[model samples]
Target: MHDAPGLVAILAYDGLCTFEFGIAIEIFALPRPEFDFAWYRHSIVAVDRGPLRATGGFMVSADAGYEALTEARTIVIPGWRSRDELPPHALLDALRQAHERGARLLSICSGVFVLAAAGLLDGKRATTHWRYCDELARRFPAILVDPAVLYVDSGQVITSAGSAAGIDACLHLVERDFGAHVSNTVARRLVMAPLRAGGQAQFIAAPVAQVPRHDLAAVLEWARERLGETLTVPQMAAKALMSERTFLRRFKDATGMTPKAWLQHERMARARSLLETSALDTEQVAQRCGFASAESFRVAFRKAVGLAPSFYRERFGARQR
Candidate 1:
């Protein structure tokens, strides 16, 4: 947690979005003593070691410039002024050095441009705001830009979609580093959901189906209620009263994932909830989630979430009072 020699450095550039910059500061820089653990040691580092003006007529001074990148364990690049402009050579070098030294790098919204310019995202699967996805992909053909996701965590480098998705990315970082409980605590303080289902497309507008299709919704609800049961696509399709092909098509159209993928995600989510909120062991949790065995649950959970179930619960679960 906070006891670790971890410094969270935010890259502050001239003409940066004050709101996006503020999101990083609010999440990482704020002091919280109730948790009885030290949170991140935070600092604002300018791209150039000088006073910088934010987008909305406010100026902020920083402690250090690119030099601060070397000392940081986690580097956060919020939003840049423009995507067309490249980051300065000095800043790019510093970012490269930090990454080479094993610092976790993050870019929120348009900040992906900085990482892209630095070549950190050259061959990586990354994302930015949905609006800039086309531009980002077009500019850097080497990078795999997935616009449908809210955020993509490719180990040391993480990039989030626009605006509030940055909050999700930051909380995800906290969850990854300190565990789920700490993340949930911080998320509660911020008055936002600890987790969001599906992808960025869920937030976008699309043509609604002309037919009223309550069947898909009903089947999903049924599956959720019967998570402990041996649920399969055939069972789900049967409940929806459609052929498997038709059901799968409509399911993907509505939710952007197949029924199997959605079920697995739901199962993992339920496993996390039970892990955090109850005293259930991994075995019970696995059974509840229809994973058949604790070993299976562990493998699936780690594959989906990048952490083991026990570790996730330890970090996120509330202590028994």
Candidate 2:
């Protein structure tokens, strides 16, 4: 089997998208003199062996072709143009071959359809752009299409939601290949949030909650300001001038998660922020995040981030310190 941290090939095609394409290059192909070890040797590969005409009346060409996908350690298919159009059989074979040889595969947005077309997503839980979730589910019934999450990593293959969510997936890959410290470095260079708090569902349209409700909005802001406090559903309901049952139903409708789940997500995000930006001890961080104890924080952080709080802090803490 091929070893980790090697060449990365991004598959391109006749129709190119600027955002996802730029994100791929920004994440994988950029020069990283900050790190002591060599970063990815990246190349853009033409799937059809021709110049590309992008959506915005632009022409582009690849540095290499499908042959690169065969040898690369990671193969990324940034947003494909259409889900209806299938990729070439040759490209499909190349992807399958790469996966067989232990190259990690990743897709952004509609690129999931290309992976799905190749049968790579047959039995995997994958995600696509929120707009195409239903179509992906209808077309590939076997693949569990999680429409709520920003991305899904099924070990060998990873899929992400539309457009900007691709950046999150790419950073996640960087974290996997290197570590949180490297990912944070890259994110800092990009001037973007290194991590996000909510899921794709939060961005999806909720007609009822789309407009501002003074009572609910006020309570939400209040709760956000006090993430360290033990904010219960009844307390929130009282703050919003609603019954507990009403608040529970409305909260889910508004935020697409129950109060408890939302609180946990906020706490997780706060913990991450603390881990990255502050030098607090694990117990202090846990207390600040409203976790019952440092042990509970460790358990929850491990479950959410796949790393212990202290270890995460060690890896992702701000370099300025």
Candidate 3:
């Protein structure tokens, strides 16, 4: 018999950050009938004894207590009640034990403080809401706090910035576990983009003016449909019927990334899909994804995916028994 995916324990405490907690539940607890494989098993763990009162004047009843964390393979800490207040000693002990046993820990927003208080974030790079980055670095001198990024994935421990960024981190974990296809499926259900690179800026400064590009939609679709070709910024600009200079400016304004970066993202996404679903060999896959050659594909794929192409296929590709 095949083994089930790991259990996810989402913590619930008094004064819970409702939106952050909801994001965890929505991503990990929802039934995913689309996939044939076993979905995650989840339990709501109570950090505070008795009934927990969440923000927005609602109560939360947990499925289990701190002891339940021992059985979980992944623990999700939503935003803590207060960043200044350290978590309970019992709770901190449980987290330390879980980490020692090789369980993964994830934190959203101020929840990073909980992990920090447990001493789990020492010597690792982490991120939190941009507003708290200074304090996190101040309180935990051992941690390297990056204020700009959406999230930081340090193997066993992952941390994300404020509210909505939690969704990006959760989706990233899903992708890490089940591959790009599964992650994209979850994102589709959530009505969000399949993947946003972790290095993406958490906050974008206001633009001088919003560019109107109702026509750029067609150009983007065109680019996707022709990823196999040697497409250039000039070509894309021509397709959008704008000068290259104007296209570059408007494109960055419309999407968070530059035109070249967006194209690379699209190409990598297509490569992942082909790797999982197609029978193409590495060279063919590279050609289809518009890579210059197999060696270039290998380097880029490894850099982007943290795995060699062959290894990724071996791990996630469709198998024939």
Among the numbered candidates, top lDDT falls to 3
For residues 1-321, could you state the per-residue lDDT of candidate 1 as single tens digits?
Answer: 234538999988888788789889999999878567667898889775556899879898887767777889999999898888878999888889999999999889999999999999988999988889999999999999999988999999999999888999999998777666677789999999787666777667678878776557778788989888888888888899988888888887778787788889889878877888899999999999998888989999999887798887766676621
Steric overlap count per candidate = 4, 0, 0
For model 3, the superposed segments whose C-alpha errors exceed 4 Å read 1-3, 197-202, 205-216, 238-250
- lDDT for each residue of candidate 3 in 1-321, tens digit (9 for 90 to 100): 124668999999989999999999999999988888888999999998877999999999998998889999999999998988978999999999999999999999999999999999999999999889999999999999988788899999999998888999999899888888788889999999887633435265565555555467899989999998999999999999999999987787666578888888888999999998899999999999899999999999999899999998877777710
Quote each prediction's TM-score.
0.85, 0.82, 0.89
* Candidate lDDT (C-alpha), each: 0.85, 0.84, 0.89
Error of 1 at 13 (Å): 1.3
Better of 2 and 3 by TM-score: 3
Per-residue alpha-carbon lDDT of candidate 2 for residues 1-321, written as tens digits (9 for 90 to 100): 112478889887888877788889998988888876677899989887657887788887788878888789999998887788988999999999999999999999999998998899998899988999999999999999999988999998989998899999999998776655667789999998777655688788756656455456788779888988889888999998888887887787667688888788878878887887877899999999898899999999999888888777766666622
Lowest-scoring 10 consecutive residues by lDDT in candidate 3? 197-206
RMSD of each: 3.3, 3.9, 2.6
Which candidate would rank higher by lDDT, 1 or 2? Answer: 1
The regions of model 2 sitting more than 4 angstroms off are: 1-5, 32-38, 178-191, 205-211, 215-225, 237-254, 273-281, 310-321
**Prediction 3 global C-alpha lDDT:** 0.89
